[model samples]
Target: MIFLKLFRESFLFAYDALRQNKLRTFLSLVGVTIGIFLIIFVFSAVDTLKNNLQKSVNKLGSNSIYIQKWPWVNNEDSPWWKYLQRPTPKLREFDELQKRSQTALAVSYEISIDNRIVKYQSHTVEGAQIDATSHDHDKTWNFDFEDGRYFTEMESRSGSPVTVIGHDIAADLFPDGGAVGKALKIMGRNVTVIGVFKKEGSDILGISDDKEILLSLNFAKNVIDVQNASYNPQIVVRGKNGLSDLEVESEVRGLMRSIRRLGPNNEDNFALNKTTILSNQLDIVFNVLTKVGGFIGLFSILVGGFGIANIMFVSVKERTNIIGIQKSLGSKNYFILLQFLIESIVLCVMGGLFGLGMVLAVAALVKAGTDVQIVLDIKNIIRGISYSIIIGMLSGIIPAYFAAKLDPVEAIRSN
Candidate 1:
């Protein structure tokens, strides 16, 4: 019955205090509101980026693996100035790996050059990339043809000067329609356009395949010959769905090692690219960002806690004579402590709820405007509330204890 009375008195005191200083209370919660807003917004934006990147990767087929001289995603420091010093992997080794590995569903190779000009009649566009690939390239890369058909294996092997244009290239060159069976000049070399491809959106890697033109590997080699044309082609491997990506990667590595006759202690000269691995790495990066955001937001909560502590201390100082009157009326020390503690908790909980509402409103706005998924899970709310209560307790402990232990005679005489 004493605890119930104390609880009611505490709530009444808190309500009266808030009603008397509404503007000050709102201003005190501003820090918390801004902190939660930043954390929630960053979380939603990063999640959106991750989802879009994963979707693009899935569109390329999850069971596919890419073999190249450089890492596929997030690779820096290529040191292209020392290209002569870099070791080149051989195409013969790929063939040997294909023969030895049963997990490989299909293998294809391609050569690429960036910023090649394509001209159709009077229209010309620069900065278009050229891809020289085998007939199996479409199947390996999941390329969808918009019109006409992919080049035949015979045409690829025979070094036919036929080309397939991406959607953007087609639109730019043949805006008036009828692009097929037309002659186009690629890098000053005349090639016949046989097909056009569908438009794929820009990816996280900044690659827009819709702006490229595809030709036979042999034809590309003849047009833009550098060195080791057959041995240094970019290799792509497709695996069956049931096969483990790790197993396929290991098998390919072992076979390449054997075919290249590398020494027992030599490091791998080639790189294997996997989309799932990149996705995991991206998750790790986001996890770190989230942790940093949490820590930064925690500072605002700490400030709010300090504000609660200061307010409780001032309340105790102002009500010293009232505390003396309550003590003389036979109120226990624990009753006094409970009143102050409950007051602090009330203020903190109100602030936390307000912050949470702000977070939800921002998340809703993000969802309505963008395709980003901003989930407001129970875990986040629970965490916020729990932290608020803990802060309240820690901040109120000293002030409550001081108010409870004050001598009635001294408190009444002093103020």
Candidate 2:
């Protein structure tokens, strides 16, 4: 009961200090406010980047492997001519691998052609992305259909003139919602639209399916040379549910080597790419970025701490006569210390809250201006508040101690 009464009285004293010197209190809080804003804003930006990156990486399946001529990771030691000379993965190799591999659940041969045009009647979507894949592509890659279905085995093998369009294409060409069974002209050949991909907005990696059209590999041969190295033909392999990507990659590497007749001393020509490679590289980059941001924020916070300490010391001096009067009237040393400490804390907390509000405003503005999302999560809020409390304690301790130790007679005589 006594402690509660003491707390109530101390809180009132802190409030009174703020009300009596509003301008001085506001100026004293500026440093802490800017410091909190800098740190929280940096943290929020880094977290937003990480989230977008993870979403992009997920689009390329985490457990899938890509067999291609060029490696995803850059190697300064290796000559570029080596990769340029490597042969593009062939359909024959893909067929052989499917027959031999035990760990792979699904294997697909895929090639892409860009800047193509698709037309329905007078409506046209130019510069469209087109992907040609074997029938097993559905099993290797994850996707959902907004309408119709993927190619059947017979249709894929027989080079049937069937196609799947992305949401953007469907919306552009057939805004009324019934896109399936419509015939669209591509490469001067009319093909039946068998499916429409679900809507996926633009992402940082430009891998969204919103602007792509999918067709069978056999059918794509009539439009472009499927075996052309310029088309970037690659094989995608998805591991079984229980198997790890490493296990799948190992089996794929051995099989490719055997198929190419490469001896033990000869290096394999093909590259086995996995999402983990990109994810690990992203981790390194983000870690460095986060550290750099934290370092900059800490400097700002240090300046704020100094400003808060200065204000606290001056506050103690200004209240010296009041402290002496209370002490003469039988107030305890601990009460004086607690009162000053609480006042300093209240000031810092107010500054922190203002900083948080600034961050929220910036986040809202950025979200409105761009597709990117900047979330100020609860974890960061807690962290900001914790920093405020710690700064308040460290800054006010010495001043509170000085006020507590003052001799009533000497303090009463001070101007």
What is the number of backbone collisions in each predicted candidate, taken in the order shown?
0, 0
**Lowest summed-lDDT stretch of 10 residues in model 1?**
80-89
Per-residue lDDT tens digits for candidate 1, residues 163-200, read 99989999999998788999999877889989988777
> What is the C-alpha local distance difference test score of candidate 1?
0.76
Quote each prediction's TM-score: 0.69, 0.93
Best by lDDT: 2
Error of 1 at 235 (Å): 0.9
Which numbered prediction scores highest in TM-score against the true structure? 2
Off by over 4 Å in 1: 1-23, 56-64, 71-86, 121-123, 142-184, 189-200, 207-210, 226-232, 263-267, 275-284, 312-415
Worst 10 residues of 2 by lDDT: 293-302
- Please report, in order, the local distance difference test score of every candidate based on alpha carbons: 0.76, 0.85
Q: In model 2, which regions exceed 4 Å deviation?
A: 1-24
Flag clash pairs in model 2.
none
